[model samples]
Target: MLIDRYNSQLLMVDVQERLAPAIADIAGVEAQIAILLRTAREMAVPVIISEQYRKGLGGTLPSLAGLMPGVQPIEKMEFSCFANADLQAALSGNPGNATILCGIEAHVCVLQTALEMRAAGRLVFVVADAVGSRRPESRSVALDRMRMAGIDVVTTEMVLFEWLRSAAAPEFKPVSQLIR
Candidate 1:
């Protein structure tokens, strides 16, 4: 089934400054994340970003931070954002019942969160193009695990087009500009 915008929420997990620098495909991951963030903003999709541990990892890199709204992130100590109290509640609070996840350390944080969301019966989609880890193998494994667990694997433009729905939709022009 196509993921509808009304039922979708964007989750940016642990895209921290200290960690992103160590990831192998930092450039590719960041580019997709920027597109994800900008699309979220233009499409009016609700977004929540988590910082794993502010003191060490620092906040999500400065560039992504600037694109997001002023919502203070749900600071999490747990690898999975689902394990954190504030993040869990805020994610549950969003009207979009389906969640789209993207972040760093794909094998760990992204994997666990996708599993948890599946247990909670939410329609979860992981944008494979938008997630990464320090090693290519871990990212590959995480995607395999999530797919095995029944999570849908999607991409940045896949989401942009899905969320946009129809060319005549009002958000089409603005969001298309982001992809362009």
Candidate 2:
């Protein structure tokens, strides 16, 4: 199915300082997420970033913050951002009923958020390359679980292209410039 840009928002889930260093394939995941953020910014997509607990886990990565300035970061204590009331309100106010999810700890925050979003009647599309876990098995399990729950699994480039929708679009140059 085509990713409806007008009906999509980027939800960057906890790419926190202390947690990110230990995740598997950390470098690759970071790179992909950077690209994803750049694409989202270039395309005027709204982004919601959640810091699991700022007093403990730390803020979203600097690279991500650089791309999405003034992102409505929903600080949460819950493992899932969906569990927070303020986050829910932010989500409901967005133009999209679809979430393009990314960030760390694939089997935990990423997984939980995807499932909850789906349950809330929002279409969840995860950027696989932008998600990671300390244990590969755990990450794989989460992906399986998300797929089982009918979440649409996608990669960073796929999301970029899908959001662009057509090569002839006026934003084509800026969007395509991201991949290069």
Candidate 3:
């Protein structure tokens, strides 16, 4: 299914300062997420960000945090964002039924969240290139598991173009420039 921009929200999971450094190719992952965040803002798509164990993991990376000024990251101990009441409430508040996930430890938080969200009957799309784990093998296996469970494994460009839908969109120029 195509990702309907008006019917979807962006969820950034645990791209914290302390935790992010441990993910392989974290720089590339963050860059992709940045593109998503910027596009989300440009398209008026609601965004929800989560930070796992903020005290230990520290807050979202300064570079990423700055992308969405004034947006507070949800603090959660649960690996699945759906398990956290606050995060759940935040998600429930958004009208969108589809969620786009991007973040660290694809095998852990990202994987669990995608499965749980999918099971809950919401359309879940995990941006593969925007998610990472310390071990590439772990990320690979997690992607396979998510796919087997019927989750859509997508790339940043796929999302960008889907969200834009066409070159006639007013956001076309600015959003398209994000990747370049």
Off by over 4 Å in 3: 94-96
lDDT winner: 3
How do the residues 28-141 of candidate 3 rate in per-residue lDDT, one tens digit apiece? Answer: 999999999999989988899999998999999999889999689999999999989999888777545689999988999999999988888878999999999999999999
TM accuracy, model 1: 0.96
Candidates arranged by TM-score, highest first: 3, 1, 2
lDDT of 1 by residue, 1-180 (tens): 797887778899988888999998889999899999888887778898989989988988888888895756789989888888899998899644789999988999999999998988888999999999999999999999999999999999999999888999998888888777
Error of 3 at 128 (Å): 0.4
Which residue pairs in model 3 clash with each other? none
Residue 76, model 3, lDDT: 95
Clashing pairs in 2: none
By TM-score, how accurate is candidate 2? Answer: 0.94
Error of 2 at 172 (Å): 1.8
Best model per TM-score: 3
Query: To one decimal, what is the Cα RMSD in angstroms of model 3 from the true structure?
Result: 1.0
Model 2, span 71-143: residue lDDT tens: 7578998888788898878777864568899987899989988898898888889988889999889888899
